[model samples]
Target: MKIALIGYGKMGQAIEAIALQRGHEVVLKVSIDNLEDNTIENIRKADVAIEFTGPESAYENILRCIEAGVPVVSGSTGWLDKYEAAKASCTAHNSAMLYASNFSVGVNIFFALNQKLAALMQPHPEYDVKMLEIHHTQKKDAPSGTAITLAEQILEQNKQKTKWVNHDGSNASDLVILSERIDPAPGTHVITYTSAIDDIEIRHTAHNRQGFATGAVLAAEFLQNKKGIFSMSDVLGI
Candidate 1:
């Protein structure tokens, strides 16, 4: 399949390597250096588009893919407030789009585990839950998108948590999501449930970008000819 990489940063380059290894071609590579090439006419050349830009450009990039009638797999974060709008545009244009916070298969499975554990811990209000996520210093979004996804899953299952806070939460109903930026760290997330008796923790760590890149390519492959919105759960069938 022909793929267009909407963000040619480290993640985009990694995706390109994985796509090529999987017998796919990357037709377009858009980055800060070449914003002029990210046009509807240029986007239409690819069967699918993989978007890994920052939140500032994710919405517009996703919309352009829809307008071009090309399927899109977006792994951007910090712009989910406009997700509904993007889905509406896809529906109106009959375009296909897949979005995921963390495309690593392991992370998705950890997501599933997180939900189950949250459900199991719902009745035990004594155990207060908090999260810690560490990423590379260059990552723009604090608390990371994967951390948000995990927090959301916990919120859905645990009624005690009504919202998530980026730091040590002051409110009892808030889920604390502490973030740290360290060099050489791709990603790391830990969900901890603490009580007077014991502590329970589940974590997911990434050694490199290959796992996420592979999943993005897989998602692009799945969305090549389909329509409507989808998540990583759809691609991994989890």
Candidate 2:
């Protein structure tokens, strides 16, 4: 498999290492130092493109990959308002695209568990749910995308949570997603269901970026020879 890496930062480098170990070749690598090389022609050199860029560039990078008729797997966040537009472009071009907030297989499994727990706790209003996410200090987005996804799942199951707040949620209708930035912390997310009696907590803590990189490569492998929008659910069959 030939891979074109659209973002050559830390996460991108991690993905490259995983991809190579899986017997895949990285044909193109685009980074901030060489933005000129991130063209549609260059993107077309590979069978699939893995995008792990910032919010400002993610949409455009995915679109170019779609235009080049290359399957793209995106793990970017904070630019979901334009997600529908990107999907439309992919459909119009008959290309494949996969997007995930956090591509850790453990995180995706945690997502499934979160939804199940939320549903089980729905009828019991005694338990209030709140989340805490810790990431490296260099992470740009507040309340990591994985936290937002978990909050959305909780909101879907529980009627009381109308929205999610990025702090200590005092409002009864808000799901608190407390975000903390610490040095050298790869990632940590905790979902706690609290009540007057007891507390039930589920957590996923990443020691490094290897899990995320591995999952992205797995998504890319699933997307080959496919044409449509996909999620990690399809990759892991969860």
Clashes of each: 0, 0
Tens-place lDDT per residue, model 2, 89-171, is 99999999999999999999999999999999999999989999999999999999999999999999998889999988468
lDDT of 1: 0.95
- Candidate 2 matches the true fold with a TM-score of 0.99
Clashing pairs in 2: none
Report residue 54 deviation for candidate 2 (angstroms). 0.2
Q: Estimate each model's TM-score.
A: 0.99, 0.99
Candidate 2's error at 4, in angstroms? 0.4
lDDT of 1 by residue, 1-238 (tens): 9999999999999999999999999899999999999999999999999999998999999999999999999999999999999999999999999999999999999999999999999999999999999999999998899999999999998888889999885899999999999999999999999999999999999999999999999999999899999999998889
**Stretches of candidate 1 exceeding 4 Å from the true structure:** none
> What lDDT is reached at residue 195 by model 1?
98
What value does the lDDT take at residue 128 in candidate 1?
Answer: 94
Best by lDDT: 2
Sliding window of 10 residues with minimal summed lDDT for model 2: 167-176
